[model samples]
Target: MILLKCFMVIFVGQFLDVTSVYNPMLTYNIRFNKLRFLPNVTGNYTIFQQKDKQYVSGYIQRPTTDEVNKYQLPVFHRCNPEGLNCEYFQSWTLTDLCTLLKDKNQIWSKWYGAFDPPILCPINQYTYVFRNSTGEVNIFLKWYPDVLNYQWKITQKLYSGDFYIGSYYNPMLTYVVRIVKITSYPNITWNYSVDTYKGKYYVNGNTSITTDKLIDKVVGVFERCAPEGINCEYFQSWTLTDICPKLLDKNQIWSSWYGRSFDPPVVCPINKIHYQIRNGTFDLDPIIKIYTDATNYYWKLTQKMYAGNTLVGSYKIETVFLGLSRIDDEGGVVSTDPSGLAYSPERSRL
Candidate 1:
């Protein structure tokens, strides 16, 4: 294997810093989007310089793994020219090989065949992009992906100059921008549904997946945004609508609807506590009787009523209250009494 001598050039301010030791006699092309870019190699081939001192430099035709698979190509290597026996091309990816060529200006030539493409991406290509001071430009090239770094080894094809073919080991292709660094979770927000039934309002909290105390973080981020003397207004509501209607309905309808009767029409306080009567019995069946009075105040018809958390008596009151008298005093009221009325949860409390 004869190593080609290539000179490095650096351009500054649209001017060459040094004259070319060799002419722009370099061209390289690669086959891409196919199984393999070159023919399979069965035996070793010789690669040597024109003389012991005289040199030739050109890009090797490296192929992508996908291209090798598509073309059914075999792998080949540019062995040492002196021995031409040991194989040295089996370990490198197309991308890694390309980096070594450009950085160190070393070249490896393929004698009879080209490198095989790996199985990950079964395609063939013949072009790759290169960057000089002016920027990236496409040249005829071949490359393979590096399994370790997801990069490619590349070889340039001689499109215009003396076809001096060789290959070299290089780092894979890379970009500062193409590489993304995700430091934190993504920013996302959600919308929820709201519903109201009767006087109760309901809202669906964050039921989907995640919840964050972003509001607390916001206060910290914008500590100066709040006024010096006033508290932060983030937690207060502007409307009292949720509870007002329900409160009014309970007050007007539930406060006075249930009660036992007295001859003088005994008045009860609006806030007396009520209890549920579970097993109270009545003298008259189906009279909607309930026990009420100072000792047993409850609605006449309600099976359950509040008696300071204790039921009044073992007996249930008749549903009907005599027009202006007690049941024991009026010989018990009949179920047909016009005053047997039903009340709501709020009103029946005594």
Candidate 2:
């Protein structure tokens, strides 16, 4: 085998100064949402206070005998107050999850340790549970304290080896941690849905579909605009045919709505005689769900069925990314905090 040496590069971008009144993102807290793609790994951790000092104590278990030497790469994202205009705040490649504990170079390193099945370089297959761990948030802010004032979403992923195109390594772990300045979780606040017969996207005010290809044309994109809601910038869009298979992932994450109590067409068959969406634009499930922490941003999605070149019927939906809500206590649709809802990694508790 030919030996090859590769260099890792760090690219730092411009950061909006937190001192500016527009981005005073001070005072933040962290939350983790645990989601397992594979069954071999499972764990949970939380931040606790002891003797005026805060620390994290928890465990990450490996039920199988598989071990990995690769480290986790974390990418931090900072968004605007409206949860729009997100940019990378900072990032780090953690060679050891216990670096906050064993790295003597860190100031508080002496105060932390891995108690059960210690975590050192080249992580072992044994389950890991640590006490007197580094203060989750403190160690984070020590590098960029000014960042605490804004909203942040950090995603970390680990693999068995170098992350490349077709090298082929199973995903070992993924961590998604959200840091916010406020307590309430961000969710959509939808106003209304277009009517079946009188909606704007309806062709010549017709409500029935003359074509069997109900999904002939589809457009989905995220849109942002000026405070006045004018002069908007439409991001790139995606074209999809049958949105049926995409529903599986959405059902897992947004279980509250796409749960067992809910069901849609299994196969969006187009080779039919006549198709009619009796409700027009209502009750149509979205392709993407719960990825955004932005309650203020909206997605414009349109789907249309056609007969030759004539437009028969169509549906246009305008909703915030997090707006595809769940049922509330009184049977009304409502969007709430993402704490217990999102399919994310609950990695931090500050």
Candidate 3:
């Protein structure tokens, strides 16, 4: 039996800027609320899969006296897009996470190349940051794999059982990692931030990208979801067959336009990395007739770079057709239900 875990409860297009589909990225957000505990907690997380990948990052202040063995475990909860109807998902001990860090990646000195903590779970007076610089992120951490084409959510319970933060308290730590979907006004360009290096993640700003390995393949996705990227219902996922190829896919939902309705993805995976691109921008202008039908919905377009099964980097553009409507693959058109936040398609109209 294939059991799934919990998810996020995003209020479609609430306060996020992202896009996706072929590059299945379940929009998410991180909420580190202040609570009565020995130490302060904060986190930065990413729940997206380029060639299918998930990542977690954040920091916990130096505790007065904390040990990994003193806590229960980090429990993850799942929920709906609107941040409702939650349930228990899974758990991971701080020690186990540490072991993976020490034994596997040997990243004790550099957790994601920016933050570092003692491999032995150093419990002295010191602040440290930890996150998956390289590895598999729990898919159900936000949404189930099967639901990639639909709107979804889940809950996460951050409790320090005297281990992570070294103070078992009543109100557990709540680490909310919300990956927001981009839905800017139609045709507005959005820049792609963040860069990933040798398992280390970086929100690349003016810095240059560290890797330019021969890109194997790239998945370009154009997905339609609610304003806040909820209940993503339509998916137009395609792939670049060579080092650099045009944006074309069998899921030509953009076929309506005589082929000139939207901007094409920039050819990528060149011999050299272009730092100049850090300031460049992209947007969604898919002129297909299907898009004309759903002018009321927000669309997210993403292009993910990969080397083998590894994700080298990615490009994202989030925006919505100012007046785009949504279409339901199952019902032809979205039902006029105010309570309905997304138009979930039974299947991708691929």
Candidate 4:
């Protein structure tokens, strides 16, 4: 039977930041139990080949005092010359180390060293102080075989610039970063704002204005990072002009137009008269009125003439010639013939 076992250790601290040091030595040692192989009575044995490539992968979570106390171990793995023990070592700058630490959660508690607290050193000086603290600083060191292929899953979206603001200076616009589905890591949504006024450009606020004066011409770069600040993927570089239009509010109103003659005239035989303004235009306004008499039904169409805002005259249609004839209340027979004289229909009534 093959057996596997894993052990974890934790250290706590308060703060962790980058230092100016170029390259600092770091090391970690891991030990494994002796291996055993079954012996065969009679057979040809083949030797297995192994590669020397190595890699380290692990994640740190925010550590609490109770968890640290429960997980702490007394004996530390020591380097051995016999090759039974594995020792991993590397040299890293303060900035590089800080970047790695930022990817971990509760970073200060899981990896800080009790004997060697990280210190800032002068650029010209090679020597730096490494002192022990109760739980003030932190660093992480570990190693494993390359086959482990360690990866860190992003839990939260990280943002750096002003993605949204109430006001903006002339020629500088605010923008935002949006990340869609990520194939490398599933179920992670990254969205944040990048504000120009916050001076996020080049990690400094100062930027010279270019000749382009159009508010839409301004552009800003946005990034999405896994683990907050390390190993980020460039999501989008958007301009304020492009995004502002989408944020504007829109209002629209729609009106219905009614009134066209039916194939068969509608019969209105009731005592109540009904009137409807069907079509109203600059040139023509048509009003339809329907009523009933004791003996016969009657339908009337009227048009009020207007020259600009001044009312010139009003005309009523004769039922015998609905479209061709019109009778004016003040000026009878308003419809004219080709000779420009008023023409009246033979049966012009009601």
The true-structure Cα RMSD of candidate 2 reads: 14.1
For model 4, state the Cα shift of residue 282 in Å: 63
State the lDDT of candidate 3 residue by residue for 1-49, as single tens digits: 1111212221121112222222334433222222222223333334332
Report lDDT (CA) for all predictions.
Answer: 0.21, 0.36, 0.36, 0.20
Model 2 spans > 4 angstroms off:
1-42, 61-72, 77-88, 92-115, 121-127, 136-142, 145-153, 160-209, 214-219, 225-231, 241-268, 271-296, 304-314, 321-350
Error of 1 at 60 (Å): 16
How many clashes does the backbone of model 3 have? 48
Query: Can you write out model 4's per-residue Cα lDDT over 1-350, one digit (the tens) per residue?
Result: 11111122211011112211112242222212211111111111111222321112222122111111111111222222221122222212122333444344432333233212231121122222222211111132223332111111101111112121111011000111111111111211112121221111101111111221122222434343432234545544443333233323121000111112111211222111122322211111111000001001111223232223433333322111111123455534444222221232121111
Which one wins by TM-score: 1 or 3? 3
Regions of model 4 farther than 4 Å from truth: 1-110, 113-216, 220-234, 241-350
**Residues 1-350, model 2: lDDT tens digits:** 11001000111111233323222244322322222212334566665655544445676665544445444444556655333345556656654555444665552343234456654555555566767554244444566655444444444344455531111111111211121111111111112222212111110111223344444443444455432235667755554554456544433332222233222322344434322222222122222122322333334444443434545455444332222234445543344334332322122111
TM-score of predicted structure 4: 0.14
Specify the highest-TM-score model's number. 2
Residue 301 alpha-carbon offset, candidate 2, angstroms = 2.6
Models 1 onward score TM values of: 0.14, 0.47, 0.27, 0.14
Cα distance off (Å), candidate 1, residue 166: 19
- lDDT-wise, the better of 3 and 4 is 3
